[model samples]
Target: MFESVMWLIVVAGGPLLLALLMAYVLMTRRHRGPAERMESDRATKRLYSQDER
Candidate 1:
């Protein structure tokens, strides 16, 4: 039936979609190490500043 085929497509594509998302995140993160670290440091600074205000 059409519903079964649609369900099969959804089930079959789930892992492939997840793998693609993981790969994309990993690839982008490889070039963003310094930027991500800086963001974390800035966030920490803001947290401490807010406490002092």
Candidate 2:
């Protein structure tokens, strides 16, 4: 009985957790625009130096 209850929780919670994660990732993804593009470019450049391959 205890094992069945735990299994059900895992089955239900796994999809619920996955859906929430997907929603968060989709919602927070970068938006397209000149300003946003420039900021993103700058961030990438700052993080990865062009001099190194």
- Cα lDDT tens digits, model 2, 1-53, are 99999999999999999999999999999779999999999989977886566
Please provide TM-scores, in order, for all candidate models, with all chains considered together: 0.50, 0.57
lDDT for every model?
0.91, 0.93
- Candidate No. with top TM-score: 2
Q: Across residues 1-53, which tens digit of lDDT does each residue of candidate 1 receive? A: 99999999899889889999999998887555888999989999999999999
Q: What is the lDDT of candidate 1?
A: 0.91
Q: Give all candidate RMSDs, comma-separated.
A: 3.6, 3.9
Residues forming the 10-long window of minimal summed lDDT in candidate 2: 44-53
| lDDT score, candidate 2 | 0.93
Q: What is the lDDT of residue 12 in candidate 2?
A: 100
Itemize residue pairs with steric clashes in candidate 1.
none
